[model samples]
Target: MLVASLTAVGAQEGPSGITQRTVFAPFDPTQRGCHKPPGLTKELAYVQENEREFLQGVNHGLEMAAKDRGLKYLRSVAENNVPKAVEDINAYQAAKVGALVATSSDPTAVSSSLQRTIWSGAFVGTIVPPPATLLLNAPQYATGKALADASINYIKSQLGGKAKVVLLTQDTMEYLTPRFEAMRDAFAKTPGVTIVADIAPTPVNKEGGFVTMSTVLLANPDIDVVLGGDAVVLGALKALRVAGKDRPNQFLGGIDGEPEAVSEIKKGNSPFKASISLSSPVFGYAMGQFAADWLDGKSIPQAMDILPIALTSENMAQYEADLENPAAVYADPIRKSTYLKMYGNICYDTRDQYVNFPWSSESSK
Candidate 1:
């Protein structure tokens, strides 16, 4: 009877346990750093350096999270620029290991790569849908639209039907158009909220930047509130400052919490009324936690998990401190320390014995 029971148990086990690996391939922005690689033009080098700094900051946060959660993480680089991301994805998929790709690059490239490689995987394709919820700091367009609507409504109630608002975004037309439409619909019934303009341009492109900024400023001189969809708002703020525009009188809000933006606010020269920050390090920790759970046979929530919160002046310090010490943020110093101490050595054997069945049973027996 014991032999029969053992056989039944083994049969039930089947391939239930996960044995593969999880990989992270971030879009390379090495060219965006100040240490320009040889043979690159000065202009190209600066762009690369800027991109590199942003991406490195993101990776630092992600790495801290992974370390705190005892996740076996590997970083792959797509060195041939945006186009090379697809090649990296193909290579990762060919290895037949599960992966969680992250990026701070153009969404078009990231989406295309995901569709061709990760999503089209012979075994398990993409983990998340197109436009990847991972980008834009978790609060995807739908959520962003809702928040914008609420904010706009509040403005309308306060203004009493005499406010003109302009929506500004650095996203390409293909990305921002739909959200613009949604915002339009959301404000259709609200009074005193006129969307004077919807400007969607490649913020970093020299020619595009000049044309878009000129057009928006010329067309909407009387615009009251400026709603920014992305970090490009920072560029807009800088431009507005140069033009001697009064920011406090003209409300400004955006979706990103870039460090520079925080600095500007701290200096009391910012027109930014509010912003939603993804708390990059905190996000990294969450990803790490999910990765650890998935690896340990604990069912992971759907890939499209709702991101936590937005940060504002009121609570930015708390979030910043948490990024510095995720253990304190996670509220379990011992567990966090253990996970960090183990780092790349984390494995089934190192997992807490209390969480393992045979060990727990044996201890009890």
Candidate 2:
């Protein structure tokens, strides 16, 4: 379970009789001169879940950061296979890889391996659910609200505010529940914006989106707005196009400013518009920087929040430029503020205080 607020005391047993440790405080961006001399090798490895565009963006950023930081960069694709992910992480740990980052299809299955890596005194960074020295997360509620609010505006102005909407969700993931909850809350206030279908697509991918949307069209064929992650929503768009049901005025928006989704939005005539940009590359670069810092015995953020940006054609070019040159974005305080919000601090000396539960700035509130 997620431990939102930090505990200042030592380890204690939870109701489930499991030990929970919380010794870290909120990150002091002002505090300085804290260092934990390099103890591990200068190697950074990423255990990627698959070759999806979002994950690929992460790989690109990490690779770029590795090159800039003068560290050996290694990558292993899990191919969405949980066992493969476990094997890859374990191998990295055995090899004493200094800093490691991972994204898993089943985080639970790989948690033990990640924990082992942490025990080895190597910096372990995780995308979300943890057992790591550094964790990356976005405010799910704010992210969902951003996308929903945009969809509401487009529906009101272009579709007369009354439209059947389809929400592709991932409600099974407890951490992601708030995103859909936020969407439902916003739409509930808009009477005409009835949610014709609210369901989690099986497999939660492009094919899942295509299949789910195809089934939904069997009844409510007039969906005006579709909201969800990029992969599935893009699949839904494909389904819409194949069925000859897509219209120019339809507002099809999604989260995760995927390349394809951005292209669709740029088309202008297509229904896709306004993807909420999590900017994986930007955060990936930050993670890589943190890893390098950790190896150098420098303090780094214990957790980070990837601020969401609502993307449109107007901002696409600049966003693309930032993704391509994330180091530049990280170097610019003003620019990095727009993309990331970091919290807590950790270094090799304080590694015992590493985050072991799901941590988020939004949830801490």
Candidate 3:
């Protein structure tokens, strides 16, 4: 039996005119990786660690937001694994519970199991960054591609419409290959963007630095921009700096941000031009608010799973403030308060909500 408490706080009109309810749930991460394989490469390990930190930060931000609003909240006081998540959902469904949130990465698995569950709606939040395939498969890649194109165009405008470029990425990132391939194809068609060297490392381990930097310098000495995926590239940048190869005038950019990367920029010594950040705090808070509204018998638009906004260096300061104080991030405190009310004392539960799939008995079969 899952024991939880619910406290209700009043609602307020959101900027979209939707009455927002606050729901606070204690979040846990220990049980989310039941099926995760061991011995991941350094790049994958970095991504996982960064993702965990991002989620924890978002949760802390939400807690602050909840306290500011004095809304009702729920707290879960149990710890369970992925399989246990399925059991909990099944039990809830058997009791004809009105609404519930379960976490899992396989949406198809969740949908298959919970198609007839008691909940009127459900939402899935991934602890992992979207796979390269998922990102490239969507129209969003067009946006990323366009951003890359614009960067190249800016370089062209400065260097007279033709420049030699080297694309560097860790070889183990199989998923990003498609997107990089798309980028290569796009660059091929552009007037002045020449692919001087497209190099990949052997295994994407700590040695990725030696392999990538050596290859870039040897194969493409005059390379202008170094386009890479994430932390691996950051590592390569550090290696370049250590070797006294990183030039301030050259351009360096990639997808995600890390502390080291920020430090590099702050020093004003590295070639890092810009980084792409998907604000996890905003995404998590939005998910929490949506869950609260759904539980409160409110209507959610079919387009609720819209892509989150991208953060660039220009507007990153505003999000940095939001990360520090979520209450100030959104204008509608009442709606946020209403959302917090849904979670009651369940905030104490540290169980991973994302490991379980479909809340139906048939899922066990």
Clashes of each: 9, 2, 30
lDDT by residue (tens digit), candidate 2, 1-365: 32211222122321121125343466665656655433456899999999989999999999999999999999999999999999988888777788999999898999878766766667888887887789888999999999999999988888887989999999989988888999999999997989999999998989999999999999989889999988899999999999999998888888888899999989988899889999999999999998988887778888888899999988988999998999999999999999998887877666667787777777645
Clashing pairs in 1: 31-48, 31-49, 32-48, 32-49, 32-50, 33-48, 33-49, 118-126, 119-126
Pick out the ten consecutive residues of candidate 1 with the lowest summed lDDT: 353-362
TM-score (C-alpha, index-matched) for candidate 2? 0.91
- Candidate that scores best on TM-score: 2
Ranking by lDDT: 2, 1, 3
Look at candidate 2 and give me any clashing residue pairs: 27-344, 36-297
TM-score of each: 0.60, 0.91, 0.56
Runs with alpha carbons beyond 4 Å of true place in candidate 1: 1-58, 69-72, 77-80, 90-99, 104-142, 146-161, 170-179, 203-211, 308-310, 326-365
lDDT of 2: 0.85
Q: State the lDDT at 182 in candidate 3.
A: 55
* Cα shift from native, residue 110, model 3 (Å): 7.4
